[model samples]
Target: MSKYLDCYDYAAIHAQAEHVVKHRKKLRRDVVQKYLDWFDTHCATSKLRFQQAQEVIPGGIEHNLANNHPFPISIDRAEGAYLYDEDGNRYYDLLMAGGPTILGNNYFGKECAQFIIDKAPLTGLYSEYERKLAELVCQYYPSVEMFRMLGSGTEADMIGVRLARAFTKKKEIIRIRGGYHGWSDQFIYNASEAPEDAACLNGIPVECFQSTHCVEPNDIEALEQQFIENEKFGGTAAFVMEAIGQDSGAVPLTREYHAAARELCKKYGALLIFDEVVTAFRLGMGGAQAEFGSKPDLTIFGKIIGGGYPCAGGVGGRREIMEMLAAGINKNRDKKVRVGGTLSANPLTAYAGCLTIEELAKTNAHETLAKASDYFMKEIAGLTEKYDVPALVFNHQSILHIDVAGSQHIPTIYKKDDPEFARQSKEASQCVMEFAMALAAEGTIISGGGKTYLSCATAPLVDEILGSYERVFKGFE
Candidate 1:
């Protein structure tokens, strides 16, 4: 219920998280082994495919999402709400292609395929679809007065940070710890990896990371302190964060806190940048910013915006800030940042983005998907309680977080140096890996580390997915 918490009871959620982590060790060993044994028998074909792919693909997989524990399952094809693996097994698609495909696997597959074939995938120029897509984004999202497309969310982040620094003429960027804002160098500071390693910052040089300030979420005082500290150096360009907290709300933040942060940014002459790559079409057409009523000066988008197509991300915001990327508007447009890509706004992705956003808006998909997500969370939470499962089932909009390792989602700032955090992170990491493998064998595709996405088509499959989860949970003893 912290999802519905008015002011966000962080202590309550953190306490539950700690209890669950400690409890995970008590789960039956035989129950887990039983599922692993089942995987060996049922996933023979997938295992063979992985063995063959390792010769070509670096880790036998291309993307991090496919990084399963033993080996990832190779999907053959997908329909509305299900994925069919090469082993001739079908699994409920809880991942939703990592939070796109709101209308399902192939919302208008035939039409889109035919259109791309008739025209061209890349004509080396613009399409009406590009303008149409931008129009739809600007119309649905109040914050997006002007928009520009990029290849992926990572590219959008790189571009967005540059735009922010350029527009504000400030060098420092303050982001919340554990906020995953794509793999851009600036944002990689506190994203993806464990929070404790934020200081070392491997690969990225010190000068690069020194331009950004990282702070823990849910504490306005810490943010204010960071703001004060930045005054000693250059001013902050932006205070960028996910609409929800890190890991797609693994650590949720209160509405009041976000508003306060926005005010702090205003006080320090920094742009308030909300990375809406995951939340854009899911929380609302205008994204989480709209749902929470806390507007941002700039917004970054990915995944759902491209409608499960390639080149699926962008940045959009107020006219003044967005127009900074305008093409050839000024010979001295070097004053404005230049954002360009080979396939920046190609027709295929533009059409997919245009059609996807239009359908989501017209169908009010968020309302339906939210109900489905909440139902899954509520029922699964009860299922965990009844079966004594050591997992926490909760969600922010359609993105669910299942704490298989049971560690605190956002650990206290002080705990970074504690051995307690390391132990819990290791335990939860193992549990999550084994749990994902178990779910795959039980006929569900989930993100490896306790997170998965919901979509408009999730309503009908909830019971089947829940039933599978229940069966698997009981087996764990």
Candidate 2:
């Protein structure tokens, strides 16, 4: 066992965290390594399981975020705000399935689950549940004159790009750097880089990023310049961005930047696409667009909309552009776009989504979750100050990012060569993992990454989480 494990008492944990700055290097290394070993031995089951997973599942995990230091925990089940791994260790779930499950796991009563089962899972045709859910979405988001369902956020964005090109008759796209819009080639360019000219990962063609220009999150001037040059380059089809940056450490664009970008998109005749796969309903009923008072030509939604089911995504916007997806206009001739999956709008997924929307709307779940998140951020901020750690807490309602180091300004979207920025990025990543591992050893889990999500967590649960933070921070002292 590591020395840190000897101090598992909550008071001792808090003392260690209070003096974290004094012993940063040792704590980061020992604490992180200890947790990694624990996860390998207790969480991953055995080397044989990992090997079997690798033989079947390419990367031994379905999603990259599920890959953790010692390998991801194979979750057994979840309820409320807690998850139980296959090893029977309980954890406070802060990952929240990467920002869905606003009502928490197993939120929907068996009635909702049974509803789907009784109605059958898939229809390979339109279902009343899909239509009702779309209408409910439009009820809150009036900007969506029409909506179409898809299998995942990736497909929603993929189809959005196609629609933008068809509507604008333009080829190029302008996306924000470090903003993750899904795995599709167009939006995947320049993601997860320094604040400079960083390229997308391998397997992606250089030509894919050639037409996809990237701009910084808050640089209004740079965005304007991109628009000006886009006109010279025969104009862009769409200016795509996460309404709030998700993968780039939850960085947000100021209201002024968004308004200016909206104007520039109008001036250049480029469609504005808000990739709200993670933001929609998570930020508010109408999402960041409604919260920030900005409107985009197209919006993509995922996560919370699906209600923790496998159901993933959809695109919604003005009728004119969305009409292209109608029977006659689309070239696919199957009364659908050339892009669609058999499970795109399955009845079970649609029922789950609709039920979730209904519950969320009835309980005003967003406001409650936001309050819980605000409490968490405030508590963490207090812990950081008390410990004299150079940490910052950032959140947009229910979603939160704990920057163990200070937040760095990502000036240009695609420029990734700045050494100082790189150093800060690495430190923040290390601090987050280390802190999270320490918390995990104390019997709490907050995603094991730099961020945390709040589900139907109540004030009592928030207090318990804060107590855990207090324990962790006190250890540093």
Candidate 3:
């Protein structure tokens, strides 16, 4: 087993599901009422704001992270580990801007903004910070020989896939279901465990996904089978996966699995692409690939890379593969595929990223955050045992996950191959939302699914954070 795999205790998680099976009704009644009453009283302004937003915004929220059960919290200001909503409610920002802002919200190199105030923001050209930031990242992630900044993580993955195809002169790419590599047209298609449900592929052309294939993580046989099938076309170009496993490591792939996966990709002449969007800085400076002991041909990064700013991600790897983006490298300059944004590598984002890494190194932020995260994960895991709740809390370093019935442990949570587990999983999902609202009521806001993206800034508030979750779980008993 991978040391990463040993980090969890699924037996305890699976054992707690019986409580959910036994007390579904009571949990629903109490948790729902508790959250509703609290939201009505405390988040009145947020509800009104969401209602108004619904008139214009498609989902009544800017992004899914801001969204909650009935509505989402509207942020007025944030500092360190806390966010203040429009309604004057304060929340412990567990989402941490969806796993970036490692040093905390509004942190852009501390003084970089002041320094850049006099300098031009963007010239649509090169800047010192661009080179400086690239140097900094290349120092931390030794696997990446060269790098290119992009508008978003999605953009990185889009180009990464294109680069893989161009480099190998191959077509098909294998991806893990329930894995996130950005929401590009190629990736959004059937990116879940339930291969039958292509609902997420609604607007994209079905033919666009003809070259993309899905396989569950840890299933080397299925992965190999996909590669075999792809050979009928042009052969596999790359195998892309979140190095920590799918759903941001909610379902972790074992050490042996990763080793086998690396071998499988090599056997079939496919590049191994590690999508480290969430795990880039959250799991440590080296990221999940280091933790899992797998080195891939390419690595995709986002979140903290740009230090919570626009144009905040990139693709990095071998010099030969990355050189495909180099224009002045050879006689045929135009042969290089275009793969950058107008604002990419701008001074401001680079300054932020440079300072972010500097701070992480100087203050030893990763170590502090990891220790607190250890406490938080184990504490939340103990909640199931302590209060007899049906949910399970597990994490990879600072990235947290709570599966209502620990269904993430059942091989694949994407399909209903096991009907009873599926039913309980759905119920537990509802339970998770309620608990999230409950946590919100107590001033801690996590993602809709209860992912607590912790930061070292929140280390001081661990006791209070734990108390908020403990109170909610005990309410169920």
Highest-lDDT candidate: 1
Per-residue lDDT of 194-288 in model 2, one digit per residue for the tens? Answer: 32334454676667767888887667888888888877778889998888664633555667777887998898899999988877887788888
Ranking by TM-score: 1, 3, 2
Shift of residue 53 alpha carbon in model 2, Å: 1.7
Clashes of each: 1, 24, 1
Local error of candidate 3 at residue 372 (angstroms): 1.5
- Which prediction has more favorable TM-score, 1 or 3? 1
Q: Each model's TM-score, in the order given?
A: 0.94, 0.87, 0.91
Which ten residues in a row are the worst by lDDT in model 2? 1-10
Ordering by lDDT: 1, 3, 2
Any runs in candidate 2 off by more than 4 Å, and if so which?
1-30, 33-48, 193-201, 326-337, 406-424, 475-477
TM-score of 3: 0.91
Pairs of residues at least 3 apart in sequence or in different chains that clash in candidate 1? 405-428
Per-candidate local distance difference test: 0.78, 0.71, 0.76
Question: How many steric overlaps does candidate 2 have?
Answer: 24
Prediction 3 global C-alpha lDDT: 0.76
lDDT of 3 at 175: 88
Global lDDT for candidate 2?
0.71
